[model samples]
Target: MLRKITSLLLVGLLLVGLLAGCGAKPEEPQTEEPAKEEALKIAMVTDVGGVNDKSFNQSAWEGLQKAENELGVKPGYQESKQEADYSSNLELLTDAGNDLVWGIGFLMGSQVEQAAKDYPEQKFAIIDNYYENPSENLLGITFKEQEASFLVGYIAGKMTKTNKVGFIGGMDFAVIHRFDYGFKAGVKHANPDAEILSQYAGAFDKPAIGRSIAESMYAKDADIIFHAAGDTGNGMIEVAKEKGKYAIGVDKDQNPDAPENVITSAVKRVDNAIYNVAKDLKEGNFKGGTNITYGLAEGGVDIAPSSDKLVPKEILDEVAKLKEQIIAGEIKVPANKEEFEAMK
Candidate 1:
């Protein structure tokens, strides 16, 4: 009886051990996954021209898109319907925790600066404007508009069948002055006898006014018109297409806008500038309280590609030569009427 009880107890113990073995396997070492880094957030506040102005605002937005696509950034923008929306749009982006906020035009200079001060920890950038005493967190970017404008003006000077061209500006600010005087200089250099008709629409978004101004110029025998207006310039290009004249687009390659009517564009690489800034921030090399200027030498501005069907090869060759001279500092393009008069 004693042997039987001991054998039963041993059997029971073995069964319990087996049950414990079958119940659950020992847990394997857990390897936790590394946490993913959050994407960099960058955004911009467009001027009154909005994001699809097909000019300045459009170029900047394209840059942001590129940063998003190439660098894996979170890109965004708020279009301003009018000047009044600048502050609100910028503040909204800032509050949303954008790593960087860009103001697309000079008109928002004061607002950008104020926002930079109001949010001292936030980073800010503005285009086409700079301050004498910028906040430590603010960056100002300007472009050498005259250099690119001069190249296209040369094209118009050579291509004009009527020996007369026109210039339409959104405003008479210093920025527009660069386009105005540079074009005048190029036309003067290319065709001394060529006459230029100039006008200002007083607004960047008034396409109707731009159309009317273009009509007056074209009616006055101006065969080619170059406009530095924003959306307003789109109207001028439309008129060129209808009237069988030529137009030079600005800020971006506008050939797609009017095809044959748009001879070429004076491209100010706002896209490239914006992309560079974003890249700098991504690389931890971005700095504020500094002003950055881009010109032909810095690849900030250039003439858009010329179609052999529109601009002749010789004209392009001449323009290329001028570009080299400008880069080499052999030629000093004037930025305004005062400098234009002083240029030798």
Candidate 2:
């Protein structure tokens, strides 16, 4: 009887061990990690004026920054120290596999075109320039700078205390010519008796040259000066402050640079253009191989709202009417010296 009882206990222990083994969980199979989406890269190559030109180049960078802040894009830029640096800088950005690269000024048009051809798979854009037959990957961005320049010129014509106002330009290129002629037209329209003084610094980076030009203009009894010179215009503003005269700024609102001296600014909305293009790219609706011109009607260019700080309300009211006329195509502003001469 004792042997039979021990055998029964052993059988019962074996049954309990089998039941525990059956209740154990099986091992789980492994899974690969999910892939993350890649970020879109955008970049620009600045002209010889450099990135902080406080005018054209600065405005373009501001636009790119806006896109970066609002569109989640990886934005970058290469500042060209000299004209020769444009191609290399653009090449560097292109080789980095950026989703889009921009050439900041018309001065880089040929270089940008060459880069676009060399890197057919990459996309490119240029500001203030257009090609006759561009590659499918290149987009041209232009603004009606003349429209905005005319408005400010009108103000200078009406507000000049000495009946003489001055216009200073950079490089004397077709682009700068637009600013020069438009201002002349506006001045002629507003004050027929006003004498307009014009000069070209032949360089956009030399402030000393700009200062000397401004001094000469002021000494000749010119009461107001409008400059389309990039960083060089900053010198004209400084001279205006010292002489207690007024200066009309360009590209961006420069009143903050010298509140007492800057009566107004001709604002070209390069920032808006940059933001729009980036948004279109993000939405996969980008239209390459085409030139788009932004004008007063498109809100691409206009006088700074801060004009009210120094510009009389009556003058502002007149400018507003002229703006509408420009937008409506009633007032044709000249884009070149030939057209201006014909209009006169």
Candidate 3:
């Protein structure tokens, strides 16, 4: 009877062990859920001026930054250190499956066209340039930079204490030349005797060269220097501060660290263009294979105002009147040098 009782106890122990083993099966491996995606994937390929050139590229990037913050986009930008990088930089963004890609300047026209063609499924927008035969996936944005320049140039012509103003451009490109002739026309209109000095920096990112040219202009009694030279323009601003003169900004309202020296900015709204494109794309109103040109009538370009000892109330009033005239078709602004010369 003792042996039988002990065997029953051992059998009971074995059964309990088996039940414990079955209940505690090996733990399974853990997995994590995927990350949430951004609303839209947006990318930009900048010209050689880079993203922080304090002018054109910077203005465009500022718009992209705003879109990322408010428009629900995953924004990315690639800076081209040289002209040769434009195509590859575009390719990098396009290959990443970006929903919308933009090329910042007219300098990027060719590369953007090639990229849009290479990736027929991709969408592209270029500023200040339109393709002769734009692909179905490409869009172009252009501004009446000349109109804006004319406004500021008018002010410069009136504001120049020395009866001399200058325009320094980045590269001798057609766009820069447009700025030149329109400004010349305005200067001629406002102060018929005001001498206009114009030169090209031969490059977009050279502040030193820009500063040197501006200094030369200042030495020659150019009291106001208007620049479309990217960071080169920033240098001109510095020189303006040094000479206690005035400078004009472009592509953005660049009052700069020394706002007092800037009489006003001849503004071109690259920011608005980029921001609007993103907004349109998100709203399903993206227009591909099209060109949208903006002028003062469309709020795409205008002149910035200044208060601290540069422009007087009367001058601002005059500028405002002129702007109205331009908007209302009372005045015709020139788009190119030839047109401006003809008007003269």
Candidate 4:
């Protein structure tokens, strides 16, 4: 019985030792599951000019794509077929829980305002329009297109052989008015004796109208023409190419399309503006209920570089000096007729 009890005790001690050893074997380090990536959803609604217009809409779209690639965000877009689709398209993006919704042009200002009011919690941005009573969730982006146009106009004025320049506008709205006033201002700045002839197509997408206007301007002895009429500007460039006159492009560098005729383009850098706003939102530094003005100082507007072949080095250097002066508060570019006249 004693031997049996001793054996039982020994067996019990061995079992305890085995159990403790098993417990001490350090739990196999657990592999933690990776954190899931947060999805950032952004969207843009195009103006009536559509996405492929190679102008405003295209710039905005390019910005959205850039955000998607860099920030790992998902972006969706809706092409506006007509004026009536603006509200619906904005609502569609918001309803889908988009982090930001962008309205591409001034034509969608009313739609954006109404939609912003309806969805006060949603973040909204609109280009080329300033809201009077903007919501806290809304941002109005306005560009100093006049400043850029002025630079291009100076180029046209200097390059014109006939001492006559022409301007083709998309519409008679404030935005278009600013472009016209700026171009004329620059022309006068470069050549005080230069004559400027201006016309409006009354439509942003009518190429035929733009072509007809260009023909009329060319016939009137204007050797250089600048167009601010979205795709309609393409028509103007075409006319310049065929007639071997000079043309200034807008929104993007269109010098490549008509390298021989296109002297320069008023680049608005809409893509950079849109991208900056999106980046701010992504970084949690979004500022709202304000009007953001991007101009020559902020790299928001300028003449394109593709015109190196057409513009003389001395002219480009002069433009650079003017750009610096504008940035240093030594010179101011006007946006309206009164300011333009005052500057003149």
The digit string of per-residue lDDT tens for model 3 on 1-344 reads 99999999999999999999999969889999899765898889988888998787988998888998998888899999999999999999988989999999989898899898899999999988966668889999988878888888888888888999999999887788778887888898899999999999988888899899999999998988899888877888889888888888887777755778887887888988999999999998888988999999998988764433568879878888998988898878887777987888
Worst 10 residues of 3 by lDDT: 303-312
Compare candidates 1 and 2 on TM-score and give the better one.
1
How many clashing pairs does model 3 include? 0
lDDT for 106 (candidate 3): 89
Off by over 4 Å in 4: 1-32
For TM-score, the strongest prediction is: 1
- What lDDT does model 3 reach? 0.87
Per-prediction TM-score to the true structure, in the order listed: 0.94, 0.93, 0.88, 0.91
lDDT at residue 34 of model 3 (Cα atoms): 97
Report the alpha-carbon TM-score of model 3 versus the true structure.
0.88
Ranking by lDDT: 1, 2, 4, 3
Span of 10 residues, lowest total lDDT, candidate 2: 32-41
Off by over 4 Å in 2: 1-34
